[model samples]
Target: MTAVPAVALRGVTKRFGASVAVEPTDLDVSDGEFFSILGPSGCGKTTIMRMIAGFESPTAGTIALDGRDVVGVPTRRRDLNMLFQSYALFPHLSVEDNVAFELRTQRVPRAELRERVAAALDLVQLGEYRGRKPQELSGGQRQRVALARAVVGRPKVVLLDEPLGALDQRLRKDMQFELKRMQRELGITFVYVTHDQEEALTMSDRIAVMSRGRVLQVGSPTEIYDEPANRFVASFIGTCNLLDATATGGVVRVEGVGAVPAVGATDGDVVVAIRPERIRLLPADAPGGIPGRVVEHAFLGDHWLAKVVVGAAVAPMQVQVPAAEGARLLRGIEDGAEVALDWSAADARVLPAEPAASSTRTQEVAA
Candidate 1:
């Protein structure tokens, strides 16, 4: 028989008077997996996290942990811990005391609490700074203390609500790896909430892209990045170039670009999305390529983003190429110079546009 999920939500709904914070949602988080809920601000990512932590009760449906219902369990009574975006450390308390506070409240033996607190600090590589208060530590260090405190009690699941959001770019990247390592070593399920797509892509075993109060898609990073369920997932997850095309038989006719074979188009106008990296810039005389004029270019460390205007389209199409090749292309090209653009048929995704009444469906995916 299959083992029960570490955390599961069945038709979970949260309504604050007239506002529905979380629509009826269902999800399953496996044991020892790193799962993330990703979306924009006010997209209900935190509402879902709060529901799991029992900080907020669902208006309907059930929340289960390890096959047992925990729908009404109080935050302190549930066998789960949460690390908040703000770190939420007590400024007056020393690091050791902060990490041991939960255990102390539970009436754990003084001797055992000391040992457990020491172990938690050591796990976060802050053992020597145990005597320092929250004000005495760096932002990243304080965040570590919050993490250490959450894990000190050996909770069945840990929920991190944008735990690394306060750190700088470099520190945030470092902590992503550190958190993933810590999660693996402890063998506990981690349900993380973040609006950062890159962070979710880097760490999650699976990610649920949310919008408004609904989950748009749940899949591995590669699946979500490569085969997005719809246009919102494609556009929200990363940079994309969209082309208006007409579907006739098995071929999609792009204006000025001619026809290309597509797999899913059946009728009407279709929107084709292609990643910038998938596009190749060719010389003016190249065959089987659409002609365009270079509008602008920006250097981005290892590569360059070249914007080219195709036909009457006002929006410039972005193309990413290696810096070395970009230098060569730049030497032979200039602003307003005509060039050719090409991409493989398999690199593009065709999706039907949702109707006006279903426009709200797109908002649901942004959560």
Candidate 2:
């Protein structure tokens, strides 16, 4: 028998008046998996999460948790818990008391509640801080307290809505690993919602990229990064050099760059998208290389970003090189210096020519 998914959405949608927040969509999240909904603000990613949590009712379709329809169920009755960006810890309560609140409300035996709270605190590495109040803890510590409280009841699934958004960069990175660790140890299904691409790519088993109230693509990190479905995805997930071209068989012709290689290019007008890191930069005199002139460059700590205008192309092509290699290339090269661009056939993807719209024709439902 096939195992039922931990969470399932079929044609689920929401609209406030005539403004559609989420289009009809279908998705499944497996048991004990970490899934993420990624998109920019006002993209309707949060609306989807809210509907799943029963905090908002869908205008159409159905939601099932472990194959049981939960459309009209109250948020408290659903077998899930939610953690928010704000931590939402009680200021006056100690960590232990906060974690024990749910159990006490259920009238669970005092001894069992104590044991569960201890286990929860220990799992979050906050056992020693059980006596500390929310204000007494660091940002990360308070986040962990909220996490411990969310998972203490052993719910079937946990929803995290940009839970690390409030922390500093370093603290947020640290908490990413911590979140992954706790999820692994507890083996609970986690559905995380975040607008940060890096965060979703780092922690999610699979990601659903949303735009203007629609899911554009759903795939693993590597798949989404390497094989973007369309022009929008190719540009949104990371930086890419998009050039207008005409493709025939395995060759694509750029206006000023001449014929280049594209393995699976569709025969017609198309857009060739290539990652900056995939292109090689050589001295302009290099044999058989596409000719270009460096227009500008920027230092990004780990790598250097350079803009090169090739032939009669209207926009500059971006190239990213490692710090060491970038130092050698930009050492004495002035703006307008000559250079060459080269890449393998497989590195350049020929995407269908279409209008890459980031926003849809509806207002997003506010969180």
Candidate 3:
């Protein structure tokens, strides 16, 4: 973090009647950083985004843009641009006009406005589409137009709210790269809000995982994924197998299974989380393995997903292996056949059981 963040939210809170949309939270976004606020619907990610964009004022606390308090500033005067999921293009306007709307609104000189607009369009690879309208362009191309318009103003930060949610899966993935490239080229700070885990993981330089109007964790993709702060974060970011266990003599005694080696600090009641990909199938009675029955299996194109009934919990332990390798491994093992599961001790993350949840006092504003 620099002396002054590109966008800073200090003790920012927003309440709607008795419902808390966002609690008092402190966030600092660095200059040129690609930061995302990720959460499920009703998690207040959007509310926080609106507050930062000046669409909604925080119920309490301060919002600073480059160390300057902009709580009372208008959106346009705040030197920020908000890109919405809807292209929000004027249907009657040409591509160039759509990108030039902000500049014209600010009454920039005709000559300089043209130069900036052309540069913006060219950056998005839509230089030739200037003569066309939003309706004439493909969804991806229209999205490019929206992006060009967002950066055309050269705002200090661009707030994007699910900007790619409308595109098809493949097209959306493609735009992730395009958006990343534009962000780098423009060197503008981006505060993106998305509920799609894959989308956030793919595009964010750093992500703040939010739940119930509170940020559960803030870290890089690897940090949030590999070292989650709690069970909510671990389960939300990716697939996780949470099994009950008890710590004793540097080993976790899993219910209905043998003892497994533990790492880090493990004490009292605990939950062990092992990723499906980390587990390996072995013949029953193999050393350092727990025997179980293969309850179900599915081919997922890139890999195979297997459910093995084991441990005290009724839920089966999941195992995933490369499609080709899985075929060879299960060559003779029929469904319901007995097998053993093994994984490196280091791969298993032992977490404390029943971590306390925060009780932040806040609510969202009413429409």
Better of 2 and 3 by lDDT: 2
Per-model TM against the reference: 0.93, 0.96, 0.94
Give all candidates' CA lDDT scores: 0.86, 0.90, 0.87
True-vs-predicted CA distance for residue 281, candidate 2, Å = 0.9
Give candidate 3's TM-score.
Answer: 0.94
The pairs that clash in candidate 2 are none
TM-score of 1: 0.93
Please tell me which model should have the higher TM-score, number 2 or number 3. Answer: 2
Instruction: Look at candidate 1 and give me any clashing residue pairs.
Output: 210-366, 210-367, 211-364, 211-365, 211-366, 211-367, 212-367
Q: Predictions ranked by lDDT, top down?
A: 2, 3, 1
Clashing pairs counted in every model: 7, 0, 11
Model 2, 1-367: lDDT tens per residue?
8889999999998888888888888999999999999988888889999999999999999999999999999999999999999988888999999999888988989998999999999999899999989999999999999999999999999999999999999999988888999899999999999989889888989999888888889999988888888888888888888899988876889987889757788789898899999998888889878999999988898998889999678989999988898888876779999988899898988898884545555565664
Model 1, which residues run further than 4 Å from truth?
A: 355-367
